[model samples]
Target: LLDGVRGWLMAGAEPLQRLAAMPTQLWRDVSESTRSRSDLENEIALLDQENLLLKGQMQTFWSLQEENRRLRAALNAAQPLEQDLLLAEAIPVKGDARRQFVLVNRGSRDGVFVGQAALVAEGLLGQVLHVGPRTAEILLLSDDTHAVPVRIARTGQRAIAQGTGNGERMEILYLPSNADVKEGDVLVTSGLGGIFPPGYPVATVSAIAEAAGGDFARVSARPLAPVDDVREVLLLWMRDTVSADLPKTDHAP
Candidate 1:
């Protein structure tokens, strides 16, 4: 062991002695080693940071997938109700010149047809204008051509609620000047037209104006149901009962 140690010292020290490296060279090597180690540590930290970011993205992906699955399940559960009605989705909005209508994801294939009543949970939105194999257009209650015979929910004072394209409101026309309707009066479908059902909340009197020149009181009402927020609506397919099937269209006797 002693001989081996002496031989190693002689051989090892000879190269250093011949090279004549200064103290500064040794310090430089040590500093370079420290710097290389620091660079390696920095690279490792960067890789760790990249890995954390990737993990966070993966977590977000999974969360969105879970949320989508939950929504799909809820939509499926809304099917198969025992009521004489069909559920349909309003999936398209056509805002074009010469054609202003909405298309629904229901049609003859889904047992929907023309003249069927389309109603939201709040109230009526429209009726089926044209139905195809898997889709239909709904003439929204706000359309200028749409008309609904409505009555005062309080006084039963009958009047025709006409769509004026004036958003969120229905124009109750042909009311008598001395009518008892006031602001905030509730208006509902009388089912007198044989189109809409009775007791469905349609709109509320937002403004009551009595123009002196106009013989009729202009009673404008805001729709209780949201026209733009219509997502899912129910179609009334049940045939009316004996009393409702009478020849007299007016429900108010």
Candidate 2:
């Protein structure tokens, strides 16, 4: 009887011991799971940071690529020109709508002078209005006070293109009501004023309004050169005879 009782006691004590050990085992498992989750969260945060860094780098890469393309295009445009060309970086001058102009790195020290013509890859941009020691100011063709003599490429019709203070539009003045002008006609510099070179694209005819009895037609044109967006310019040194009659003034006309 005593032996059977001892066996029962042993079985009961074994179960109690296993129950006491279960809490410790469960705590250890929970600690391991928590550690694994913490590690996973830390890894995720690190990846996010890396992703942002790469995105920023990509933006810089795209910007550099665009700048390189622009420089190459400008160089190609300068190669075929017969005139002496100087490449200069243009900096925009803000404020004062009446004085719409840009300053270039080239100046009097670099042989830049008043009345020098400035061009972009597309076409004529403007004329140099003032020259300093290290910088020169160029008067944009879109300034209200600016004007250029132009001829219609299709019909050889001559007229004066005056700026409307808007970068995208200009007015063709003194065309007869019966003039052979139409939309999409290209207007090029006639070189009559002696400030700009001949045959360079100036503007394109966009619209025309003619009055029944008026002698002149109201013509609107869009400038060929991106006057507001140009970042680089080519300064041309024309023959002395061409620029000899150019007027020197604080403001260009």
Candidate 3:
């Protein structure tokens, strides 16, 4: 009877010992699982950061490719031009927003001069205003004080296009109500002022409003040049085709 009682006591104690160890084993398993989950979360965050960086790099690469294409197209356009062309990069000056002028990399040292015509692949850009040693300021077509002598390509009717202090629009002044002007009429430099070369595109008529009983019509035009976004420009050394004794009334302001 004593031996049997001792064996039964041993068996019962073994079960109690296993029951006491259950809490520790459960805590260890939970801790391992939590650590694994935290590590996975950290790895996923790192991957997301890398993905965003790669996307930003891809956008920059695409922008560079587009810029390269535009540069090539500009070069091709300049190849057959009659005037002497000097390639220059332009940067917008930081100042009043209404001032529509840009600083070009070329200047007096590069033979740039005041009143020189500037152009891009699209059309006429502006006229050179001030020239420094290494840079020049170009008065854009959209400056409030700027004006260009333009003629309607369809009828050869002469008129003046004045800047409205707006980059997207210009005003054609002195057009009679019965003038042969219409929407979508192309305006080109008429060689009357002799500042800008003749036959260069200036703007396209966008709107026409006849003033009630007034002599002049209110006409609006959009510049053909990418005035708001042009980065590269060609400074033209136009030949002396027009006489210098020509009237300066139509000259650019």
Clashing pairs in 2: none
TM-score, ranked from best to worst: 2, 3, 1
State each model's CA lDDT, in order: 0.73, 0.81, 0.80
Tens-place lDDT per residue, model 2, 1-253, is 9999999999989989989999998999999999999999999999999999999999999987875675455445432444556678877667576677889887766778898888887777889999997899999899999999988988988999998999999999988889999899999888897777777788899998865698888999999889878788877776453244323433211
Candidate 1, residues 26-114: lDDT per residue as tens digits? Answer: 88999999999999999999999999999999999997686456344333423332224556667856574443457888776566668
lDDT score, candidate 2, position 106? 78
For candidate 2, the C-alpha RMSD (Å) to the true structure equals: 8.7
TM-score of each: 0.60, 0.64, 0.63
What candidate 1 gets wrong by more than 4 Å, as runs, is 1-83, 97-100, 240-253
Better of 1 and 2 by lDDT: 2
The local lDDT score (0 to 100) that residue 71 gets in candidate 2 is 45
Identify the superior model by TM-score, candidate 1 or candidate 3: 3
lDDT of 1 at 23: 71
